[model samples]
Target: MTHEEKKKEESHGRPEIPAWMRAVAEVISAPGYERWARQVAATGGCSAPVRLVGESQVIDAGTGEVLHIYRTADEPTGHLLVACGNRRGAVCPACSHIYQRDVFHLIRSGLSGGKGVPEAVREHPRVFATLTAPSFGAVHTQRERNGKTLVCRPRRGGGVCGHGVPERCGARHDGADIRVGQPICPDCYDYAGAVLWQAHAGRLWHRFTLELRRQLARRAGMSRRRFDALVRVSFAKVAEYQRRGLVHFHAVIRLDGPGGHDDPPPGWATAQLLADAVPEAAGLVQVLSPDPGNGQRVLAWGDQIDVRAIVVRGDGGGLSDEAVAGYIAKYASKGAESSGTIDRRLSCGRCKGVGTVTMARGPAVCKRCGGVGTAGGLDLDRLPVTEHARRMIRTCWDLGGRPELEELRLRPWAHMLGFRGHFATKSRRYSVTLSTLRQDRAEHKTAESRQRNGLPGPESTEVLAHWRFAGQGYTEAQEILAGHISQRAITARRIEEQRREGA
Candidate 1:
């Protein structure tokens, strides 16, 4: 039958299938189905794969001979697919999973000494340190002691804040309780102070590092210059968004020789000494935020600080290299989403992010967003964000307007709750870099492909490439298929792991 006749026939006395299912059926029956599947599998089922139309030539440099040529037109699908390497898990889980693995190796290689690092570096003094943001207000929290849960902020006598809200919470809270990070009295919370602290968090960390070095020098009874010549501090830190919509740093701090991890640390450098210096430095280090109409405020680390020695094994009440690496890597893929904020940027629905719109009266500041260009504008109560997060975002918007604070760009990062620093960072000599790891993987993949295709080696050949962006992401049907492929890949890896363990 003709195409039109076949469609008419199928429509007779039959329930219509969903559009997505029909599209999937079309994909499965297509001639290029196998090739598309292979491409998707290669990307590890990336949710938003970038499509490229390109041609590449591998030529003999000495003889000017073309050994191999690749063109997207020759492929079954008219495009080459590449993974969107977004690190945020909420944005791209498959890519983020790969990124997390890379981060794990990057951290572990420094701690345990592998991937070009000397094993002797393991003897260097190192500690796992947590630096927290100072509290802006009392919030519902969960505490535990001796493996038993404790009530949050109990008070001897009932008291109320200036806003007439209770100043204490006596009830025990679960880990997943929605109110765990909420302020006991939103009206009494120092929203401006919190936002300013978030903005200056990076600066506070820089000052803390400097103070840590100074403290270490003082402990060893040496001048700052003399200490710098003898010892080098290295660290790998990840910023985690707490339930209170603020970020705290989890860092692995190590003391190495002035030459870096390759050199032996000074005799006086020890894990206990490094741990002792951490809290002292954190306590003393502070940063002053830009004045935003209100009075300037001092930003400092919170009172609670944790510093623990890192051990090769966890047998001695210390963290192991594997556990520490894994712990930091887990947070590398997260962001402010944990605090009930949207991952994507929000623009004013009324003004469409242009700050002002033509109205019946005249062009005026957007009443919805207070001309700040964010959704829900001045009326944060209507936004989906938590009350605490809403207040933080509102503070960010308000402070972002002041000319003095313009350099901080608080409005652009308001989604991040005014924090605009890289979530994962490391000192220069901490370990192998993420870029190096990625390059090595790419080179290995290229070599494998050349070997499989029986092509000449890179040393004997030169490569020239041309590519242009075609598109990104997937249709509903493609997304469904990619999800299935991702699940299968995960299952296969799990099975292989189990088999290896059994063996």
Candidate 2:
């Protein structure tokens, strides 16, 4: 149909769908729309479902009979649709929701024991640990004591010192304040320290874990090797961005038998021992590196290291397992989506080397080909970022030039403030993995499809298919329909969450 005709028809009785969406809307308005809709709906409305061209046939292993056959050519889109699977909600909400559910199950399984984890793991000691970035300078914080909002950075007689910035602001800052994480005096803030510290945060966690094992062994008056043979430590952690743009870790740490979670921990091993070792490990653990400008510096964790026991069922002891699992899972899908933290690297370094710099002139040099390693873009310079973050990025860029710090690759990751680590990680024996869970779910889905269609299961035959990466993303019309589907899926997920909470 013509664009104008479709518009007129939409106006006559049906709700007006966008011109780009008319093609998909017409399909929905066509006969046998439910089956077509369900095909797209199966992906939960992925914004960019992969388009695959393939065919498959289920053959009976014994009789060599073709029980079922399917091909992408017969699909509504003329290709198969699969979730893009971007964990970042900002990038793809539908995929992120799916990821979150998987992480939730993974974490919950480890905490309370399920999905291949033994129930004995529940009896083993575990702690919810939070590792934070050290203070660069005083920033606006919401502090409350006994339900009373205290003055932020209260200074006597409106005292103003070095840098001429306000020494105190008595106004109890709320969440909406734009200056919350901004350093009180950007000049005084250790921007370089913050950036370098971020680069080492992951290593710092590594050191902490290593030291923890040593500490536990020392407490037991045994050698490290002997400790390793006696008990095992397992943990699952995810990085979360603070308002200040630095990354902190939220981890669920558990103790297990040498055999793994399925086995009980040694009698001497306890949750309290793990908790006690955490503070000492954090205090002693330090990443030693030559400062970008100075000689040597010791990077340690923030003072506010939190280690709380995770109570599986009732909250008579500490926080519940459900809350801890849900909290970690919430951030798992976030994938470092936050303000002032650039999600990707800047294009400037694509230049051959740092020897020569291409300066951007009148019109912005599109970072495509002509502008490779170009300089003088005020795009980031003009943004209203906190001076703390601004300097951190600048430090990353400056440090990138130093040969001594070449391994850090500060310039390439200046956008991330010099952090180059996975957003989510777990040690072996933490629980079932995302890949395993997805595989199980897919197998179950295949079984369900076979039963629904009264077709023999894959067990009865050898199924083979040829597939190729046709493309990714949807046409404009498909995107609109996908958006509709994704939104419904999100709503359904929320309803499920609410129901679980209510139950």
Candidate 3:
């Protein structure tokens, strides 16, 4: 059998106890198994947990008397496990689900106004806008109308391109078709332009926001300075990867008074005005690509810009506030990995770049792949990605080596197809920050723990903590146990949500 086939068979082929199964049995019967299981359960079964060795002390601030003490050495295991807060679902589903829920609350608060924001902000002018990348080449796209799929890129003559590739395709591609995002003519595709556009997408978005303010000012027949002083622009946006391996921004743009959400915007600042300014600003904004070999190229937003008015209720035929918030939150946990890219970075195959590999018996220094991450590494040529994404990755690698394009750092972000921007971002005045949300949750948990333990409040005590990173992730045996816990947690959460909705 081939290597892939053998690996697949080993996972599900027979009922015999394999080496991994034997390891699982040993782990389950180990002395510290109960403690390990409790730690894993507390982390919500994080796929990749961060391991830490630490000691903490809580002392009375006024008297300097020791109040409480904790150490990893006291636990059954030598380390403490913390969830790796990765937002990408492909990397860690449990953590991603938490991140998604947090994002939803963040966005919803900015709309309906909660979590330290004023309720009056919900009455302010706001819009849901989609800014798309300019097309570099004709790609296979799925289109539907009136409950029926339409032929993709149909043409009367069905002519051929300069590369002797067909210019038109009549097939009706379904959403799951492999050719849904591939180029009709690979040779004729503008790979360089596409990569450059992707690299500069963040800058393009920044420029568009600036131009939007300018457009709003001009529409109001006021100077830019006066407009800035009178009104503030707040937004929360998430980047979603299109099927063609490019990112498009979906944003909730709002107008507020100069003092922020607490103050009312000018009377003229209506949702209709914001909607009118969006398309004009997107059409006007442009960014210049790095002049690497090819002369400077101008990149701008695509023609298919969508701007919709956000309303309090969807019953009146406008996009609802909750709908817009939920839509942006849903895409927050996604990345280029959704487009068939690997979730983790390529590294040493044997040791996985940690300089050591866990053996059947115990951990051992890897001699086969050495300590360097590149030894026995993945072959980029054999990556199981789409042809379009492969070309984009190759282009990023090639351009990354040039001295002129060094600032883009394309090599490290090849998995993202040259897109190096954050998946979710927001203006300072938009709402509560992700860090703030996380901090609040942490404080709440700490308070609950202190109450349960009959410990003093943080205001009357001082805490000192010392921690060192140990390692991350789980062994084969722990992974199986954690996976079951994670599924159970998800099912429980779903049931709770259904119950709440029904009530």
- Per-candidate alpha-carbon RMSD to the true structure: 4.4, 5.5, 7.7
Residue pairs with clashing backbones, model 1: 369-377
> Candidate 2's residue-wise lDDT over 77-136, tens digit each?
677778888888877888888889898889888988889998778888999999898998
Q: Each candidate's lDDT (Cα)?
A: 0.87, 0.80, 0.86
Residue-by-residue lDDT tens digits, candidate 1, 1-503:
99999999989999879888999999889898889988988887688999999999999999998889999999988999999998889999878887887888889988999888888888898899999988888999999999999989888898989989878788899898999989999988888888888888888988899999999999989999999999999999999999999999999999999889899897899998899999999999878776656567678899999999999777879999989999999999998988888786665767655578898999999888888687765454566888788888878877777778878878777788988899989999999999999999899989999998899889889999999999998878888888898778656755775697499
Which structure is stronger by lDDT: 1 or 3? 1
**lDDT, residue 30, candidate 3:** 87
What is candidate 3's lDDT per residue for 1-503, written digit by digit as tens? 89999888778856767888898888889898888887887786589899999999989999999888889998877999999999988889889988998898889889999899988889999999999988888999999999999999999987999999989999999998989878999898888888888899999999998999999999999999999999999999999999888999999999999988788899999999999999999999988877677678888889999999899888976889889988999999998977766565554556544456888999887886565433465566678898888888778777876778878877667778889898899999999888989999899989997898789899999999999999999888888887887678667776886798599
Residue 387 displacement (Å), model 2? 5.8
Residue-level error in angstroms, candidate 1, position 361: 26
Best by lDDT: 1
Poorest 10 consecutive residues by lDDT, candidate 3 = 371-380
- Candidate 3 overall Cα lDDT vs. reference? 0.86
Off by over 4 Å in 1: 1-14, 347-383, 493-503
Cα TM-score of candidate 2: 0.84
Runs of candidate 2 exceeding 4 Å displacement: 1-36, 57-69, 342-368, 374-379, 382-391, 475-477, 493-503
